[model samples]
Target: MGWIYLILAGCFEVVGVTGMNKVIKNKNVQAYMILFTGFIFSFGFLSLAMRTLPLGLSYAVWTGIGTVGGTIVGMLYYGDSKDWRRILFIAMIVIAVMGLKLTSS
Candidate 1:
């Protein structure tokens, strides 16, 4: 279940990133709640994942997921750049995350 927790942590990290974007655009209690709650859950799950996963492997995968997730969120909801180069880099990150998962025991 360590992998599950790690994936959840990564997802929550994206939620936190979204909250950050919201807070930047509009400061309010709801946004603040989302921001703090997302990070709290993210860190909690990450710690749980560390119990079974190697530190380096876990951190790399977590950040990879977050980076990909956040970038996609930006592209989808925030109207960030959708250039081919940006998509190519996102795909690379996904491939790297998959490779790490495959290599890990």
Candidate 2:
């Protein structure tokens, strides 16, 4: 349950990131709503996740998910570079995240 909430928090973090970009580009009421709503839910779920997950482990995983998810979203929707090197680094982050999860109890 904690892990699940953590994952959800990470997912919302991506939404927040997206909203940030939208706000920067457009700066409308809808953009503000997305940004605030996304971050609010993200923090809410993160706090819920902390009930069972260790602080360090949960934080690392949450940020990892956000990093990876945000990068993918940028590449797919926002025209970020899809360079091989960038992808390789992203893959490395994924591997390190997996390693952390494996090490955690």
Candidate 3:
């Protein structure tokens, strides 16, 4: 389904972003490969979902997923900040994404 593709796209987006961080931190060629592959799959899945989903709604959901996922990844692996404010904002984004999905026909 379109939603499935969209979700997968978001997951891959996180992978790609994490890969980019890895590449920068360690200059690993394998990380670069992951970056390339993850992005390619991310966009590919996003495009597939766009065939049926509304553009604005789909994009917002995709970016919301990527933003939240990337933030969590940063906190978990890269030692990024993890405060109440950050958690609250991430929750808001998740709520917005859920709202979009629920409101869409």
Instruction: Give each model's clash number.
Output: 0, 0, 0
Tell me the spans in candidate 2 whose CA falls farther than 4 Å from its real position.
none
User: Ten-residue segment with the worst summed lDDT in candidate 2?
Assistant: 96-105
Winning candidate number (lDDT): 3
Model 3 — which ten-residue stretch has the worst lDDT? 20-29
Cα lDDT tens digits, model 2, 7-97, are 9999999999999999999999999999999899999999999999899988998999999999999999999999999999999989998
How does each model score on TM-score?
0.98, 0.96, 0.98
TM-score of candidate 3 versus the correct structure, residues matched by position: 0.98
Candidate 3: where are CA atoms >4 Å away? none
State the C-alpha lDDT per candidate.
Answer: 0.95, 0.94, 0.96
For residue 4, model 1's alpha carbon misses the true position, in angstroms, by 0.4
Report the C-alpha lDDT of model 1 over 1-105, residue by residue, as the tens digit: 999999999999999989998899889999988999888999999999999999999999989989999999999999999999999999999999999999999
Candidate 3 residue-wise lDDT, 6-69, digit = tens = 9999999999998999899888889999899989999999999999999999899999999999
Local error of candidate 3 at residue 52 (angstroms)? 0.9
